[model samples]
Target: KKVELVTQGEATELDKSLVEKITDPLTHLVRNSCDHGIEMPADRIAKGKPETGTITLVASHQGGSIVIEVRDDGRGLNREKLIKKAREKGIDAPDTMTDAEVWNLIFAPG
Candidate 1:
């Protein structure tokens, strides 16, 4: 039996058209997470963490807006390479911004 571990909003609130379009993209993201994000069994053992890594999906309503989150205890964003790439692309990423802001540069188009 499948059980919903947690949810805080109406899952049906999603726009039907957009939902249908994004379903495959969402599935691909989850599958990619399983394949590339989560470490292998042997690697986890070597790292001294649990053999099986965990991926969590969260949904909620906040300030009258829906929120969806997919998270994992895996390798996180690479900041150094991101900043270097930004410079290479001629993006003037001021040093005042935080690491999180620098990381967002990766999403910016060339």
Candidate 2:
């Protein structure tokens, strides 16, 4: 599978220190998008999507803060898989948990 990166709002400027502070975290987000968010070529084709996945990074100023967003064109988190993993890790993953809660389990420590 192939991944394409598209960046937007390149004109948005920030202080050098702020950029340095954010660089690592932003890189991590992009890497996660490529690694976890994108699907393989066969999987994408089976799902009726193009063979190549796209990850978009956008930076903009909103109110008093700068916002950076990473978006990907791929299958999103699998709820059942996440819940199963959480339970396997001994986390309390009840059937009543909301979709958002299940998704957030990805951030939980194993």
Candidate 3:
């Protein structure tokens, strides 16, 4: 039910620093998720979901750190494609790693 012009990060009483650090990165991440991460209407329909898939961005305080999660029910990360692409770039990834770890590896410096 919240609405605003800028659509930037929100802040709780203890979130001043967190709000600053996450605002720009969060904006870019949301833009990327909407533009590239989520599938198109036809793709969603083919995958057995509704035409418009929902993207949820949540922020909360978890102990000493703030936790933010950007999630969508659309297609998750494609592990095989990522591994193949990484291997093409000569990055060695251990097979014992999980998809979540592999996803972070995509953000690592090459």
Candidate 4:
């Protein structure tokens, strides 16, 4: 699948220490977005989307805090699959959990 990366607020500067701390995790998120978030070209086209997937990274200031966001135009999460995988990994994933809660299971230790 072909993916395009778009970065916004590239000039938004952070402290060197903070940048060092966030670099690895941010890289991980970008990599995961490319590997798992974006779908194949054919699948995207079949879903009425463009053949090329888009991944966007934005950085900005909100009051005193800096916010970074990563977004992708792709088939998001599969709720059923997430729940099943969590359960398979011995993580209790009750159906009553909210979508946010279920998605957080991705960070749980397996």
What TM-score against the true fold does each predicted structure earn?
0.65, 0.86, 0.72, 0.92
- Alpha carbon lDDT of each predicted model: 0.69, 0.92, 0.68, 0.93
RMSD vs true structure, all candidates: 4.8, 1.7, 4.8, 1.2
Top-scoring candidate (lDDT):
4
The prediction achieving the highest TM-score against the true structure is 4
Select the stronger candidate by TM-score from 1 and 4.
4
Clash numbers, per candidate: 0, 0, 0, 0
Name the runs in model 2 displaced over 4 angstroms.
none
Query: What does candidate 4's lDDT look like per residue over 81-110, in tens digits?
Result: 999999999899999999999889888897
Please tell me which model should have the higher TM-score, number 1 or number 2.
2
**Candidate 2: residue 63 Cα off by (Å):** 0.7
In model 3, the runs with Cα more than 4 Å from the true position are: 1-11, 94-97
**Any idea how many clashes model 4 has?**
0
Candidate 2 lDDT over residue span 1-110, tens digit each: 69999999999988899999989988998888888889999999999999999999998999999998989998898999999999999999999999999989989996
Which ranges in model 1 have alpha carbons more than 4 Å from their true place? 1-13, 88-90, 93-97
Q: How close to the true structure is residue 72 of candidate 2, measured as C-alpha lDDT?
A: 96
Residue-wise C-alpha lDDT for candidate 1, range 1-52, written one tens digit per residue = 1112223344637777967987786677566567667777777778886777
Kindly report which residue pairs in candidate 2 clash with one another. Answer: none
Residue-wise C-alpha lDDT for candidate 3, range 6-98, written one tens digit per residue: 222356344478669878987877666776667888887888877776667766667877677776665777787778778788888777779
